[model samples]
Target: MKKLLTYIIIGSACFSACKKTEEQLYTAQDNIYFDLNFKDLSGNNRRMDSVMYSFALFPEKSVDTVWLPVRIAGMRRSEARSFRIAVDEKATTAEAGKHYKSLEKEYIIPADSGVAKVPIILFAADPALTSKSVRLKLRLVPTEDFTVTNPEYDSAKVIFSNRLEKPAWWATWQGELGNYSRVKHELFIRAAGVNELPVAFDAQVLPKVLFAIRRFKNFLASPISWVADNPQEGYTLEPAGAGKYNFFSITNPGKKYLLELNPADNRYYFTDETGARIV
Candidate 1:
């Protein structure tokens, strides 16, 4: 009878040990991993894999606040989660409450959702904005619900500049501006020593405009403009309506510069006034 009792007790202890181990394993498998979504800026849904995740804020416009998104990469849990955020002063140049406002409190990622936002309000009218851009560097800290898997993506920066700087695409064109077109606005960027070509003020203008501009700057411009050798014949930057623009060459006033999306060669050529490609 003692042997029988001893066996019963040993079996119960083993069962308890197995149950605890199973619980521990389940907890480990349910660990959450989170990362900043850099594609929020690029629209690619993939991390940019760069040193700094930078976002541009145009405070001159009515957009006073921008939301930076953080995402959890693992399985979504039924319970809601709150993540911690801290300003990395070493990475930030903007002052709290002056250039930008701090987030009021912790933000909760909703249950079964992978995304959360940290809203940063930019003071576009701040006097400091006139001189240069103020940078806000934010970092995601680990919380009970999740761990930041990639430190590089866990940090992001917001650069707020009221000044209109000449885009990098301007280096390619030797174009001159005439009277402002009804469709576009012309202003000289203060520090860039070049005119601002805001062709329709949309996001996709950078790469397309750069492809044509550099070609004009490198190959064309015969003491006149980016499009032609003669003053009256060369090309100029002009705005077309509805967030579109083209290289306007006087020789063919009706011909519009067309930017092809994702061509195999990836080189944009300015077409002639006859609607034929100049190349």
Candidate 2:
């Protein structure tokens, strides 16, 4: 009888452990939040009312085991509609650890909802990137049941910029302005001068440029002008030798700007009377 009791106790413990594991697997994930607002060409704020939207993972980060959330607001419980999310082919892979593919999934927001949140799980070829930060291109569309009046009512490209390392820029600035996006708004001096030596400058100036670019991107407009507000600013643009110099290119339509000094292999170059490379 003692041996039988021991077996029962061991079996009970194993069952409890399995139950705990299952519970962890099915736990609710944290809510992904995005504050939405509308902006015009001038970068002014325009309020939107009861907007309905959904988001999906980018093809590069979509894994079979990965689950993403699609939230709906101002949706009624009795209103059911279908929506689609898009994934990029270039960003997708098929390898085990490194390969990721975009999964095309359709969802129907149930009408029985009162402020409902939906978690859409993506089944991709790889499982490792399930938790890694990746950008997903998502499109929300109305199903046959609903009609969208706006022709632009296709999908919204949502960017997930959470990662360990932020984007970097390498270029030179001339008279007016320069712009680049960093992981943190807090700018750090990686190097200074042609020798790429350590240096310091007015931290306040960096924020002005960074904030301006962000405002441009957010407002989908350019900064009206660049400012060199700090009189005590230490950094200076060292003159490059005689060559054709190219100013910054406005990749996006906005007041924010970026400048490139002597871009190699391209026709654009900055030079003096005698043709030579500038610093």
Candidate 3:
């Protein structure tokens, strides 16, 4: 069977800013790691299986649902299985009663198939659980004439922090690079506690800048030559200074370009006129 992979940006905000409270800024350097192991009914290895795991953060001390995916390979036919995840002794005092019982599920790994994976998302259901660290254990039971070769397991943790002031416009593009290249780029700005402020730029400036680079694509090898050839037409290029202007531009040889005055890194991103990601 063919495998599928997908990525979804759950929540994102581009032009909006977050508000900070009067509470002292909280800084945390806590890091936690998890170790996972899997075994079958006969106490043997299950090397032919893989696992996917993830976790989310909840405020006000609450336990949330976690999703885990299990993949099996090197199987002859379909199979039935049951699995459960446990917390460490230090994590919780809940007994091994109905709450800790494993959920029953069945899976089929096709004959001569490359690999098969299953998702097991369950609720931890801890209402007053706000600890920064948690441990999980996996148990599996298989039905059929097969052996558990290699048990596969992995773990992840989430970090929490307090929100800070809104970022400034100049905080977006701050970095150092020797040459130009193509890649995905991002821009971030700090608000400096001032709300409803907009970055000033002429409406016609970007298109004209792009047109100049398109006309002089060959001379973009050298940053000096590229800037000299492709000067800003309608707007004045801000010189390197403290607060007046901190912007720069670059032009590549007919490639994509980006000229970010306020890059996401809190520095500046030098780009050509074509709006491609370039350093």
Candidate 4:
């Protein structure tokens, strides 16, 4: 009887201890509710900031989706919470089903979770995007569980662009290259019959000009005189707009010449030493 009594007492104490702990946890949970914010692509939530998703693609490009995540700061709950998203039509340039798939109206922050994602799939090799960039502005609405803490970053901007983007090198000496902007660069690349063009500099071979040499022969219908100098060097040229080649001729400095890809003649024409077309 004594042994049975001891076991019963121990069991009763354990039950009360469990009940007390449960109540404590519930009370703690009730005291906490955290601010909700949009997480950047890096998964860090420093501020509720607008998100930008940008991409460039070539023909026969593969389609892909960019995921934007939302985050909350407190304890996880068993019940799901919903957040609302609406397209800001006045601010958006992308049409639904053209640049991106239309986003759903609501996304759920799943039970016991602090983060959720909204997937935006951008179509690949979009011919329209080649000439221009399409923008989709998405605004987050006030929900029962969450409100915008910062008005500035309460929306998202999605840009689907395939236009040629100038390389990082241009940030320093773009003016010398005839103020080559992204659009101009895209035009040059497209005319050259290439998807992309990269600028390369080598002090050993030529320091003043950036050289990107490759299968120009395949792209061009016929050969030019410059091919004798370096067959690989003149495959594609960026007429740094204003009728000037993108490269500074090593043999001629401080003098920029005009290079035109003459589709009619099936040849590239550049002004020679005497300002005559060297075909």
Q: Listing every candidate in turn, what is its Cα RMSD in Å to the true structure after a full C-alpha superposition?
A: 14.3, 19.8, 26.1, 11.7
User: Against the hidden reference, what TM-scores do the models get?
Assistant: 0.48, 0.26, 0.26, 0.47
Candidate 4 clash figure, as a count:
1
lDDT of 3 at 30: 14
Rank all candidate structures by their lDDT, best first, as comma-separated numbers.
4, 1, 2, 3
**Candidate 1 lDDT by residue in tens digits, 65-93:** 76677777666778888887788889788
Give the per-residue lDDT of model 2 (tens digit) for 38-83.
6988999764322321111122222223334444433344556555
Where is model 4 more than 4 Å wrong at Cα?
1-55, 58-62, 124-126, 170-279
- What is residue 251's positional error in candidate 2, in angstroms? 39
How much is 19 displaced in model 4, in angstroms?
Answer: 20
Among all candidates shown, the one with the greatest TM-score: 1
Candidate 3 stretches with Cα past 4 Å from truth are: 1-67, 75-101, 110-116, 151-279
Backbone clashes counted, model 1 = 2
lDDT of the candidates, in the order given: 0.53, 0.34, 0.31, 0.55
lDDT of 4 by residue, 42-130 (tens): 98876533444334433223456877766654467899888787888999988887677878878888888887887878764456665
State, as a TM-score between 0 and 1, how close model 2 is to the true structure: 0.26
- The model with the greater lDDT, 1 or 3, is 1
Clashing residue pairs, backbone N/CA/C < 3 A, model 4: 216-235
RMSD of candidate 1 to the true fold? 14.3
Query: In candidate 1, how many Å is residue 232 off?
Result: 34
